[model samples]
Target: MLKKEEVKKVVRPEAPQYVKDVVEHPPFRVTTNTTLETLASYLRKFPIDVVPVFKSIFSEDVAGVVYPHTSLLIKSKKLDAKIGDFLNPPIVVKESWKIENVAEILIAESKWGAVVVDEEGKYVGIVTLRGLLSALALKEPKAKSVAAIYTPLGEKKSRAGFVKAIERVSKIFKKLVGGEVDGYVVLSRENGAVGILTIWDFVKSRRWYRGAGEPRPLFGTRVTRGESKHTGVVRVWRIMFRGVAVATPETPVEEVAKYMATTGLYVVPVVDKDQRVIGAVTVWDILHAYLYGPKEGREDIEVRKAIEIVVEKPTLETAIGIRPSKHVTGLRARDVMLTDIPSVNIRDTLSRIRKVFLRSRSSIVAVLDDGGKIVGFITRRDFLTYIAEKSLGYWKRQKGKMLILKEQVAPGETVRILVEEGTAGDIMKTNYPVVAPNTTVEEIAYKMLAAGTDYVVIVGEDNTPIGVVTKDELIKAFKERGRKAKVGELMTPAEIATVNFFASLHSVIKKINAYELDGVVVTEGNDIKGVVSVDDLALRPIEETLRGEKIIFFTKSGVLRKVSTGLRRLRYSKVGTLMAFDVMRPVSLNISINNDVGEIIDKLLENGVLPVFDEQGRLVGVLNKMDIVKDLARVYITYAMPEKVAEVKEMEREIKQS
Candidate 1:
């Protein structure tokens, strides 16, 4: 166990003066006026999957929302389309407030929270729902859903007691599957009551007892569908800190990584002195910069002149993840920042913010002003605060505990009593803690630790907050800045290395290695779109690797049954039917191509698919897996084509109108 102070004192050598500054990452904002086509192009440029939507719709004082996975965006992008109209308000926030405030607001809204304006109407940072949850994971009490009270089913049972044993297990399984008492039971095989088996043992079924024969696959009567639907409709509500982070042009590189890591973020959007997201510095880039300093140094003295002390033009495309993490431990600011990123207007919403966050896995919403300068931050936490405050107000009104504002009081008569009633304005914090890219650990750590707040808004020399620095970050840097005797510096502009969206995941993977990267920036021209990370492509299952030629069958029980002897495949329908004769192998399961779900799960649980096959073996479609869950997410529905989908557009319109 480590005390907060103890954690703060172990100065990380990598976090030298150089790390405080940065190189490059991603830009924060985009305009609502930009068409969805433009936004889709951005999605292909980055590794993230979500972006924040900013700007109000209908000339109202709020920005609405949009998502990439929904059919609305995907359909248009796949066919070169755009969002014809705005949907919802964007998540907004002020830079001065605590990050936790955003978490509170999100919970109250029962929707993704949006951090809007203060009473005086100043734009702040936008926080996502997950951003709030991330902060809460570290600094707040957490809630966990309690499932069922589980107990082991005794293994003791007699051959006569087998029926009873199965019954108990079934009851428990039913409760869990039925969504009743959320719990599971252990399975067991009791020769009598004394012999016991666990639920784990039951699920790990090896070979059931056959009266006088060798082990054989159990035949289930049920059948199921194997095809998955990628085109189904889904509802998605996403939030992003649709903004960027700013640092003084001179901030150190190591400190920049420290700033980003403490917030549990990988990319810190770097801004110029003007508060523009000029570039970005990622953890790997800054780490490389720090390591650049300690390599066979000629001498410790003359720190600025030390060999390889500064990082120049440090694009991942150049260095990639080439050097070991051990190196680049004390390099300078000039070594790490990638100058070329993207930028968007604050009024831009629905496209970049929601999708970029999804691809980059970053939380900060970099708010940029009219000149493409970062001026504010939008974090998930900010949204939570707004919703919570509003929800509290709603409840107060319901309980008649709400206070009337002085502004709403009558002007002429004695409205002093009414004026005494307060408004949410009376309780909202006017002064919130924030930092700028140039702010040092010592300067900001004190504020963060004292307040127990994690997110700090990063501003520029102009006093406008451009990004954010959390409490965790300040502590990390403050402790580490003291250890190293030498440091590095960087000042070159950063550049992005992008790939075409239509490129195969394989091609993207190849490009990553060429760059020696953990991820690649997917982009179009100058705008950011999406990001592709190594992790994103790592788990893809390869076909033609299932070990051997396979055979499928359905048992009387309706479960998918596979029987393989490393030679041939077989499908069976019924056990004692005339179709069983002259059969080289028995086909167990049968299937149909229709899209009904409830009918499928029931058939699958029986054993495998249904139906008996003919001698000619000309067959219909088969069933394998349910797309119910897949349809819930954003996926490319393959079996159903797009043209066939448009016929139902009227249904979509009707629901929207209703």
Candidate 2:
């Protein structure tokens, strides 16, 4: 076992320095008297997200601000209106304030920009969220592995589950006190791909709900009939955006940080060579690294020991058979291919297609035929570009008449009208990038860059979409495999927690909660088949439950039952119709018990959990990232044993005498 002192003595290379000593962009001043046309022109000319609006140009004090959305509202209302009408109070931060604190305030307010003031209360500059991210990117954490910080998909998938998961993650994020993660990643059991569900996507979905005349406690108003109304159930699968950027263990922190800054991503999943999600890297993680460096010490031995005891002896791992691997090899695309890739039926609606795009969080998604064969594809930019161009063209053609029409149109109706302007077929591409399962990481990267896209479909011999690999996945996979240390010393030794494939979903949920586990292994007798968790439940929603319709079903004993009005019974209805086998995620990867410790840590950091197997290929134990952390902190070992300390002192004295 590696000693704490030895581990601490291993000096990490210093991160890239932050060169800029001051905020890059100074706050451009605008006045309340500034015309909407002038503000719009300024926005078009400048690469800024916001500008300070003051009572007068001569006044040094900022009155409020004008942003993109505010500009839109101004244009939609009165083009001649003054900027003051739409001004919102600015979130001002002192120049000396920690960037992390600034980030927290901005995130909470959903504001894109904050005014950085000097000690004398003079406006010095503006700090947009992206700017802070960019600045942080300059001094990112020393890259050890992406898995060290990536948040797991955990046991979350339903709307309620999503809400709870977000809340839970938010709480964890708050504790970071340096930066925040803005979204959650879901490894969809339904689709068999690692996907993203962002807070902004949720915000958009909330708007859709409000547009459908549903009462949302969070967003209190309803849209009028002229706008599109999305009345379907809001499932995680329907609204999640697809595709994610990923990083490997060896990838530099600067690379991940720069990507997040440029792309506005808050988190990036870390994957091994095989493309399995082992862990994730987030802005907060980077911030922590930036502020505190890698944490190690003999200083909080009690706290470390307490954590080790609690996490090392987890009841969930004890119930589930999981273990660590002995060796990690360079993996091919086949290792990460998602067998249950999501595809839209040819007959599906634009609404349905839109939902799929949101669910995948991918700019591009597969379109299928009636026979479930691949046909074409749809992309985010295609529809979005079409909408903006069409809207502008229509407004320009109408000229004066359009301005009148806009004045007459209700505020809620705007989005609906815009949505009605296009359909799935309008923006879908028939020819998209595709790759085979055996493709290497280098080849995949070359293909993606050559095709000028971040995502590609993985196909089997039959030319059907088996899975997908994104730009992020390729970037992360580039990190080479690691070695040193053994799995037995690193992995958590536990009996696998599992449920039969035929078990009810409710039973699965109950079991997971009872055991306080993220997921449970699905088994057929003594053989492990797959895994099931809360995310599966969140992704799979029963139609009857959403519609609140009466569902009559027969029990296995031939008994008849009717479920009406209540969601629990409705969920139970789904359970009666489908088994755990219906929602279980296929097990594609596991580590050997004799694998190198470095390989085990890499796996745990990136994958969240490691399924340990014995030499005979039998499942043995499971090791989670937390378990590794505890072990690293020397929580399980007695601190500063008296005999060992005395022996160390004697040895030191002998050396000194010599």
C-alpha TM-score for every candidate: 0.21, 0.31
List where candidate 1 sits over 4 angstroms from the true fold: 1-28, 47-62, 69-72, 76-81, 96-101, 116-120, 143-658
lDDT of 2 by residue, 42-129 (tens): 5533435457877787887899876644443331355588888877788888878767677667656766677778888897767765
Q: Report the lDDT tens digits of candidate 1 across residue range 1-658.
A: 9777777756421211210111112233444655655554454332121244545333433355443322123322333343436445555555445544443443344333454455476543344432332232232121110001101122221111122233433333332222222111111242212112221121222111111232333365322454334322211101011111223334444333323322223333333333333333333233223323321322222111001112133332122111111111232222222222233346544223434434544433455567766644443233223322332111111112222221211111111222233222222233457655544443343344333233455545787644455422322332233222110111011132344433433344344343333344443354333444332232111111000111111111111122341112211111111111111123334333332334334443232222211244423222211111112101111122334234345545687999
Among the numbered candidates, top lDDT falls to: 2
RMSD of each: 33.9, 22.0
Off by over 4 Å in 2: 1-60, 63-113, 118-120, 140-143, 152-181, 190-194, 199-210, 213-232, 237-239, 272-279, 295-658
Clashes of 2: 46
